[model samples]
Structures are given as structure tokens and as C-alpha cells.
Target: MYNRIILKLSGEALAGEKSGVNFDNDVIKAIVGQIKKIVSNGTEVALVIGGGNFWRGRSADSKMDRCKADQIGMLATVMNAIYVADFLNQDGVEAVVQTPFKCGTMTEEFSKASALNHLKNGRVVIFAGGLGHPMFSTDTITALRGAELEADALFFAKNVDGVYDSDPNENPNAKKIDEIKCEDIIKNNLKVIDLTAASLCFEQKIPVVIFGLNEENSIVRAVGGQKLGTIVTV
Candidate 1:
């Protein structure tokens, strides 16, 4: 089992295909239950959730400046982090929300040492804000945080079961790759994550496991080393 892990949860997972509402409580708790099992197994967890559920800044019309749009997306993440942390606490898990930008009592300021300390004390630290800047996706933040925190592995609990050779949704012949090297992700221009995130993980020699969270027990199973999906390694 991994001692510590970063869960890169997509905002769509929490949103549950809804367009208007920000979050779906049932989906959030279901995901939390999975993490609860892992935490009960003595694993430390840190989460970096995306903000697509609330806003897609890049899609908000070309009239808006890119930086301003991205900043709106960042605030959406802060909202998610706070809400998720509360849900975790309700489920008997201690959680803290940390942001790269200050949120005035809503969350603690994020730092490697503070986040690590929370993890050590058996609290799930939820990292909010995407690298505290615009023009960066949450995927990149996931890689950066995973490296900074020295996590054993980065768990991308996404919608897809694994990395397919092509778009599985579109291409019926697409095949899932069970195992791959990090460099292959960069070379092949894989969509598992952005290029910057993949490159950073490769540079740090951090292993990434891309798995579908829709399956039962997927989260705990992955942490326990069950190869249910793509295992991207060094």
C-alpha cells in the first residue's frame, strides 16, 4: 500500500453531468467513502480537485481576458475544496482545505511542510487553487503538488478506466494500455494529462496510476497495488 498519495479528481466526477448546480452531494460522498476506506487502511491522502463543475473559464467567450477567465476558474476550485472538506468531516474524516491563494479562514495557506504535517496527523489535506496562476490546468498542479509533497504515487481517479491508444468513446477499436513509461506519455502526446504535467512527473520519477473511479472499490484497490487500470511508471 502507498504511504501517501495525491488523488487528482476531476470536477466532472463531482458534478455528475449536471450543468447548473455546482456539486452533487451523493457523488461527493461516494468518492469520499472510497477515500475513507483507504484512510482507514492507514494511508495518507491529499486531493487536488478540478473546477470544471462550476466554471470553464476558457469557454466563457473570447471577449473576456484569458487571465481573468482563468482566475474565475480558480475560485471555483476553492469552492469545491471547501465543500469537499466539509463533507469529509461529516463522514468522520478530518480534512483541511489549503489554497495557494489566501481565502481568509476558509482554508490554510498551502505549503509543502503544512500539507505534509496534516497528512502525517491523519488528516486528509485538500489542495485548492491551480498553482495560484492562470494559463495552467489543474492537471499541471496535480503533478507539481505530487512532486513537492513527495507522494509515493499520483492517483488520477478519472472517468476513463485507463489510457487507450485512441479515444475509447469514439473509436470502437481503441485499446487500453495496461502499463507505460512516463516518457511514452510525453512522446505519444497522450491525453491522460497535459504535456507539462506529464513532463514534470517524468522529471521527478513519480509514478502515476490512471484509473476509473466509477468502478466499485477502485480507489482503495489502486492504493493497495491492484493494477485495475493504466500504471504509468518510470
Candidate 2:
């Protein structure tokens, strides 16, 4: 159903066995293996990844000041981008990392035109550093890039299988939603995307597929419109 899609991955998914703040090479390769399958299916992909595995911005501020914490979080994302891009390249896929904040020798400047150029060239562009600003999550960047690139949909892949009424990890009785409206996510306070990200997609009339990356070939399934997760739409 989607020709071009923006895929968002949580940083925690990159951690193999460790609880958090660690990189697992095998996990990165596993994801890129799935990404290769999606690309082979003639789907163009752009990526935005969170930095929670290395650093959580808000949590870092509990020890240091807010701005300093945010910067540390941004650097963590840049490191992930570098590793992910390298892994994709090793898998024989052309991948580029673009950051909203400049990191010489690591990534290119983040811009809609540059991203489109990469997509047109059949390169997977990984957008890093969460819109290059503090207080904005990678979810917001995912929505913004989805709208800007005119992608058919946004695929939000995390550790969980799909969107739930409550935090599935914390609530055993939480029900997984197959589909939902953007308004329901907002009004019901569903922990899908943040308010700003949800609002952007709603206003842009963009469809989102919230799915799990734990399963193999999940990205391909998402692009193929398989019934693998919850659909959030207007």
C-alpha cells in the first residue's frame, strides 16, 4: 500500500541482551536484513531512530541541567546513526545519515531536499538527532519527515507488538488495538506518539503503522500492509 515509507525504530531495540545503553551488532544486522527485504520489494525507506538505548534526555536532566542532557542525547543518536549506516552499508545497501544538527565526518545536514535526493537515488537515509533540537522527540521528526517526503505511511516499530490501551509492559490486561483514529489516540491518551507528532500526522492526513520489530521481516510486513499491527489514521 505504501510505495515510500518512513520507518522509526526505538533505540532500545538496538540493544541485544543488555537492559539498555549498549549496542548490539547482531541486532543492527537483523534489522538491516529486514530492511533489505523491504527494499527488494521496491519500497523506498527513510529512517528515524530514537536514542533511548544510550541516553534518555529527560532522565539525564535528573542529574545535570536540561540543555546539557539534551545535547548528550543528541550525541547518542548520532553514534547510533553512524553504526546503523555502517551496518547497512556492509549489508550492501547504500545508507546515509543526515542530522538536523551538524556532525562533521558523521552525517550530512538534515533537509527535505537532501533526503529526497537520497530517496530518489535509492539510498536509505537515516534521519538522526531528533530534528536537531531539544524537547522534540524522534516521533516528531518521523511525522515531519513523513509529511515532507509525501510518504504513503509511517511505520513505527518498537519492542511492543502494537499500540495498547495502556503500557503493555506494565499492564497485563491492556488490550492491543488493531486500528484507531488519531483523535482516539489523543483523547484516550494512548502512549503511541507524543501529542505534537500525532497532531502533525493528523493534520497532514498521514497513516501510521505501529508495529513490533522483535519479529523477523516485520518491516517488510508493514510495507506490504499485512495485519501485523495497529493502524492509526484520521
Candidate 3:
């Protein structure tokens, strides 16, 4: 079992399969339940949530400034982090939201030392704002935080169950790789994560577990050393 881990949750997963919604209550509840169980089991957990549910800067109109669009995306993630933190707290799990930029008292500014302290004290740390810069994904933020906190592994709670040779939605023959190396993922352009995030994980030698959040107790199972998802080795 992992002593500590950084979990990356995409906004799309929070939004669920339904459109025209900011969050799916059932999905969030299930995720929070799993987290509570893990925390009870003595695993230190930190989260990095993506903003794709509210906005995708890269998908914005060409007329809009890229940096401005990304700023909006960052705010979206802050919303997600805050919501998740509150939900976890309501469910009896202590959680704190931290960001790279100030939220005017809405959240605390992120620091490696403070975040580590929070984890050490059994508080779940939620990281938002994606490195406080444009053109960077939350995946990179996950890698960065995992390295900084010296987590045992990085957990990718994604829409897909695991990494595939091709887009599984488009290609019926796409094969899921049970285990893979970060270097090969970068070399093959697997699209499992952005190049920057993969490079950082490789450099830091951080292991990653990629799994579908919809699966029953997926996060708990992954952290428990169950082989239910793709394992990405550094």
C-alpha cells in the first residue's frame, strides 16, 4: 500500500456523463467516500483537479487571448478544488485548498512546506491553479506536487480505465497497457498525459496509477496495491 499519493482528477469526470452540469453529486459522493476510507487507512492524500469541466483554454476561440483563456481555466480549477475540499470536510475528512495565486481568502497560497505539513498532519491538500501559468495542464501540477511532497505514487483518476495504444473511443482495437514506462509514453506520444508532466515524472522517478474513477472504489483499490489499472513506471 502507498504511504502517500497525489491524485489527479479531471473536471470532466466531476461533471459526469451528463452535459450542462457543473458537478455530479453521486460521482463526487462516491469519490469522497473512497477518499475517506483511504484516509482512515492512514494514507496521506493530496489532490490536483483539472478545470476542463468549466473551461478548456486550448479549446477556446482563436480570437481570444490564450493567456486570458487559461486564466479562466485556472479559476475553474479553483472552483473545483474548493468544492471538493468542502465536500470532503462535510464528509468528516479534513481537507484544505491551496493555490499558486491568492484567492482573496478563499484559499491559502501554496507552499511546499505548508502542503507537506498538511499531509503529515493527516489533512488532505487540494492543489489548484495549475502552476499559476498558462499552457500548463493539471497533470504537470500533479507531477510537480508528487515530486515536492515525495509521494509514493501519483494517481490519475481519469475517464478512461487506463492507457491505450490508441484512442479507445475511436478505435475498437485499441489495447490497454497494464504497465508502461514514462519514457515510452513520451516517445510514443500516447496522450496519457502531457509531455511536460510525463517528463517531470520520469525525471523524478515517480510511479503513476491510471484508472477510471467510475469504477467501484477505484482510488482505494489502487492505493491498496490492487492491480486494477495501468501502472506507469518511471
By lDDT, the best candidate is 3
Clashes of each: 0, 0, 0
Q: Rate the local accuracy (lDDT) of all candidates.
A: 0.90, 0.86, 0.91
| Clashing residue pairs in candidate 3 (N, C-alpha, C atoms within 3 angstroms) | none
lDDT of 1 by residue, 1-234 (tens): 789999998887898766677788888888899888999999999999998888887686878999999999999898898899999999999999998988888899988998999999999998888888899999899899999999999999888899999999999999999999999999988888888999999999999999998888898888899978999988
TM-score of 3: 0.97
- Worst lDDT 10-window in candidate 2: 57-66
Evaluated with TM-score, which candidate comes out highest?
A: 3
Error of 2 at 85 (Å): 0.3
Error of 1 at 123 (Å): 0.3
Candidate 2 C-alpha error for residue 186, in Å: 1.1
lDDT tens digits, residue span 1-234, model 2: 568999999888889677634788888888999888888777889988888888886684576877778777888888888889999999988999998777887789888888898887779999888766677888998999999999999999978888988888899999999999998888877777888999999999998998988877888887887898899988
- How do all models score by TM-score? 0.97, 0.94, 0.97
**lDDT at 168, model 3:** 96
Task: For candidate 3, write residues 1-234 as lDDT tens digits.
Answer: 788999999998898888899899888988999999999999999999998888887586878998899899999999999999989999999999999999999999999999989988989999998889888889999999999989999999988899988999999999999999999999998888888999999999999999988888889898999997799998
Q: Candidate 3, which ten residues in sequence have the lowest lDDT sum?
A: 54-63
Instruction: Report residue 15 deviation for candidate 3 (angstroms).
Output: 1.3
